[model samples]
Target chain A: MTAAPHPGRTRRTVVLAALLALLAVAMLAGVGLGAVPVGPADIVRAIGRALAGEARVPGDAVIVDIRLPRVVLAALVGACLASAGVLYQALFRNPLADPYILGMSAGAGLGAVIALTLTASATALRFGVVPAGAFLGAVLTIVFVVRLASLRGALDVTSLLLAGVAISYVLSAMTSFVMVFFRESMTSVVFWMMGGLTAASWPYVWMVTPMLLAGIAVPLLSTRELNLMLLGEDRAAELGVDVERFKRVILAAGAVLVAAAVAVSGLIGFVGLMTPHMVRLALGPDHRVLLPASALGGAVVMVLADLVARTVLAPVEIPVGIVTALVGGPFFVWLLVRRNGHR
Target chain B: MSVRLAYEAATVGYPGVEVVSSARLRVAAGEVVGLIGPNGAGKSTLLRAVTGSARISDGEVTLSGRSLAGLTPRERARRVGVVPQQVSATFSFTAREFVLMGRHPHLGRLQQLSAADTSLAEEVMARTDTLRLAEEPVDTLSGGDLQRLALAQALAQEPEVLLLDEATSHLDLNHRMQVLDLVRELADAGMAVLAVFHDLDLAARYSDRLAVVAGGALGEAAPPPAVLTAGMLSEVFRVRAVVGADPVTGAVSVTPVLREEAVPAAGLGSVLVIGGSGTAAALMRRLHLAGYAVSAGALNRGDVDQAVAAALGLEHVALPAFGEVDPRAEAAVARMAATADAVVVADVPFGRANLGNLRALAEVAPRVVFADGFRGERDFSGGEAARLAEGLAAAGALSVPGDIDSVLAALERFTAR
Candidate 1:
């Protein structure tokens, strides 16, 4: 069908393009601004030489092996979490919804600890056992939460959030118990729980990139149904939306996104919560613009946050989750205060 | 006109409980049907059954002779548009965007709204008088404006059948009229409409046929004049109301008979209220509610007192508009005044047509209670009515200041004697 020339479409297109440019700059900075700082031309030459199977430069190993994968992985995880945030917020019609609010992080953390305790060799962990366990745990936890929140085929959003919080507490306690029992793996578990991109690698990036793409694309295509959902379920249904089936599909997609992000980055917080809010504040709540804009905005925030995490203390790397919360928490509070002041 | 929407003996509710049973309704093209009932009488449930939100457990709801059970929600929505009582929006969409969403059922999953759809949204907004609000955020609108926006959205659907569930309840009087008038215009243009109204008078005024829902069953749908009656108001609505044609608009007007439980016992005595031109309406109502058998006389046919007297079902004498009180009306008043235990003369102006009523009150002088109290410039009978009032006062007729309470007190003292 031919598109009508809408007045809002032009502004939305400009905003999306601007966000894409910002995301590219953040990724470039993430790849070049570390301890072994590489310039833009040197970074490009390194990628080109690696693709052509030529000889390595002095910083080629640092660019290709470390910073490139780390930046790519951060972008994928950020997009996944932020897109999942948009989906959950629309599904619940609640402003406070986030990617990890449904106990997915706690469940994934528990699963990773169990896998860490079970595996005796580091090679097994390198071969994708821990990420697999984390992905499975996150998906199962979301399914359990969804089932618990449904009553007679209708999903109650309030009960869903309440059950998620309760399940998160229980799963975290179980993870702590396992950590205390397996003292040798306690440091690894604690570091993972704080959430970092330190395990970023080529295999990890390849595995999660497809899931993140799918997570963003499905919701982007279903923006009409997502918009209808903001009008409330009954009204949306009356207006021809299959609300129950749509909810199931959206919840499943959100589960995949959060599971994929948590599997690689271990429990990154606030990117999911703050990215959508920022994009929505700048643009509007129309999911057609919101989903893609938030995905890009999230990538920018994550890449920059990850950069600060590794370089701010020289050799000592703070968790990326700590940086996001420290930066995002105050920014979100300021946005809220400013919004309330306008009203 | 063909029936565009029909509920064929439908029993609708959720699982294991029936909210409305054995309901049969037909809304044909080019007509508006009003559904009215008390709270919890399942009026809204029946409307929901048409949209498949509430299930029709036993029978079927059909759209244009096709069973609604076989239709997809999109197909049903393409044919029917519903404006609910209220909608609480969670996000901030412009009013134009909200209206454009009503075109959703006609578009494909990934299709954008065409230019025609945008213009149609504008058209509907204009019809609902909400064009100025097109750029305003929907969450910032008042309740009435939101309700109108909801109507505009439903109209943007361009459905063959429209359903409104108390959609105008939040609107003020002018907006209510404007909305319903537009609904009437749409019905005239061949759109079938089924509206649920809490305002009985508005329903009686706008509906081509009114269907009553009471005691879990749907009553027969008929014209407003046939459906809105005293018996139906008492039986179905639990109200003692006087249902009559409005004196000016010729529409059905309902005046409730509010009798307090602490009112004195009936058959107290007979009271003949001799007045006209609306001077005796309040006194007549007070005496009637105070257990007196009240009658009025010689009122012009189109006068306010005549309408009030007819609505209260009082025994009275009537005259033609601007006509003198003839011999038959005068004789009827004389007979009523002779039998009445007390005669009440209201503070009506002394015009030539009603001068005979004052003469009749003079004949029943002992039981006369003159409530005129010479308050205003009431004399217009060439000083004859003034002389009659003085003679009546000299003949031991009680004089009360022109208010119902004092008249009732004088009547009570006369009854005690």
Candidate 2:
């Protein structure tokens, strides 16, 4: 057996480095451009002073207390959704499959709507219970979808997608029923569904950061295993993937990541779907580079989109989800249409 | 030598219905076993039973004398590899990454490929001649390339036992040879191989032993010549396919008497075809479907002509399998040929084994026709068969292509008289 060295090794590494640099630029832009116009020099000085044990530097409150938590939460949630997106795409062996294709978003939306209305008076309950309900709803929906999708020891794509779609509609209708009966809490519910990072505090950021890290770490370990799945589940099993066990574990891991992201950011639409799909198309589907690159790309995209949400039409905030959709929707359709034309 | 993979009286099934029943076969280290049978005859089911993919309801399948039932799939995969017909890919994976995944069973969770593992995958890619295409995306690969890549992945596993289900069916002539050569090399390297093949000739050329599955069970395992008898193919495929040795390579070759499924839509009345070796295989099929109740005579048993005759269900008096043209069989064939309204001597090779078929055709000369273009080529019996064919031609017998339209016209002429 000869080494037969990988010719693209150095080229891929260089590409990765460039992506990281882009992420850094995007993060800086996210922090620098805002309604108050905190320049890069002022932000640098504030960071330097804060490192030197000065908490009262110029723009210190805006940089540290107000905007910093939101920025960090945005990065963590983006990482969570993108990594989860990679896992879901690999698990189902479908390029079009996304994190929420299996009813995760629909289930979470139902839970958020319920929890928002139930605890209008209890502010602490709103913080904890809404995320908790969303997570529970996501887990339940996925479990049901898995059960309903598999037949005679095989998962049929048509059945899985159909089941997910049907379950989503039923759960959404139930959420709508609750909303119609209780109009008083509709405004908060709608705001949560629209999705934002504005409510991100230090506590909320800390609560989900560990979950996001787990999401990123688990897929990193299974990069090769996930690559095995691209060749279909039976082939993966023959190649020693313990395919049934792998499916369960990967799906659970992906759902956990989705729970953390949706719980924090409400329902940011396209970070999970667009980031991984676009990255795989541009770069090959080697999950080793893909996992980390997507993590960075997701983080970069989320941070930049949040900045737009923060500054656009100053003082009257639009949801970050709307911006991502407005960007992803047309681009996704164009990619598909162009691919079809080429074929 | 001890067997690495052995199935004993195994009845594999889905739910309650058995697909392969009571099959007994073995593959020792350094042996290649070719699995051949008609479609749905359980060749694949037998292979699947080894990996627990199919239920082995009534028999034992052991890897190195231990049942695979006790071993986990990963443990089993560590020792056995499968190359299925089509490997569907959902992503645009490079061929190298896809082949490297064959090492998964040998590594631990969270373990990267060791330098040794990478070397093995490289060796496998080189062996499959896929190194040049290693960086190509699998989704964009041609069928042959993807098939070769699948084989390379199986080889990268470096397992003691390998199972290939129609692995080379989609490959071009060059890649087909490459894959079969690689299979031989792997066998010589002490790997056991069980390959399901539709091409009997290729199977016989490569396999150390041939396992003929038929009638819901595997027949006796033996050398290719011993197991690939005309009787077996006739019973299994319901096609009269003759088995003979290649003139050059000397490998056993199985030629189905009639390969084309294009059974003629129009049925001519009955017509007689004089066939031997593989001369009348196509003619028999054409005559049968073009509305003639097709029959042929003096065909040696276990020959291509006999097999095709059997496959087409045409009534023909066949000689004994691989022996002399006995008086009783020759007389019966002559009688049948003589009584026919018209006989067409297919442009078959004239050898000592089938000189009697020509003699029978000579008896029906006034009613006989010869297929065009082999006017003098088939004279292996010194020219005795040729002289007889020329004498019949001198008697005003027709000579034509024996194609569907031509044969139908000849049948029409015979019926008109």
Per-candidate TM equals: 0.87, 0.85
Q: What is the lDDT of residue A24 in candidate 2?
A: 70
Best by TM-score: 1
The RMSD (Cα, Å) of candidate 2 is 4.6
Query: lDDT per model, in order?
Result: 0.84, 0.79
lDDT of candidate 2 over B1-417, digit per residue (tens): 779998888789787889888888889999999999889888988877777667888878999888977888788888899999887765677788789888888888767677788778878999899998877878888888898889889888878999999999889998899899988988998999999989989989999999888778787778899988877776676665657798877999876654345456564455778777777777776667555777888777767778677767678777777655566666777788766778877777777776777776656777887776346677888888778877877877778884656755766777763
- Looking only at chain B, model 1 earns a TM-score of 0.86
Against the correct fold, how does model 1 do in TM-score? 0.87
Model 1 docking category: acceptable
Best by the lDDT measure: 1
Q: Over the stretch B201-310, how does candidate 1's per-residue lDDT look in tens digits?
A: 88988899999999999999999999998778767877656677877767787776643343356678898988788788788887888889888977888777776777
* Candidate 2, lDDT over the whole model: 0.79
True contacts kept of 2: 0.67
A1-343: candidate 2 lDDT, tens digit per residue: 2354554466668878987898777766777778777777777787678779876855787886777778878888888888888888788776556656677877877877777778878988876887777777887888888789985467777687778778878887888798888888877666766778888788888878877777667778888788888887768777877777878788777777888888878777768778998788788788888888888888888998998898888888899989988997787667668757965
Which candidate leads in DockQ?
Answer: 2
* Candidate 1 reference-contact recovery: 0.60
Please count the clashing residue pairs in each candidate, in the order shown: 0, 17
lDDT of 2 at A159: 80
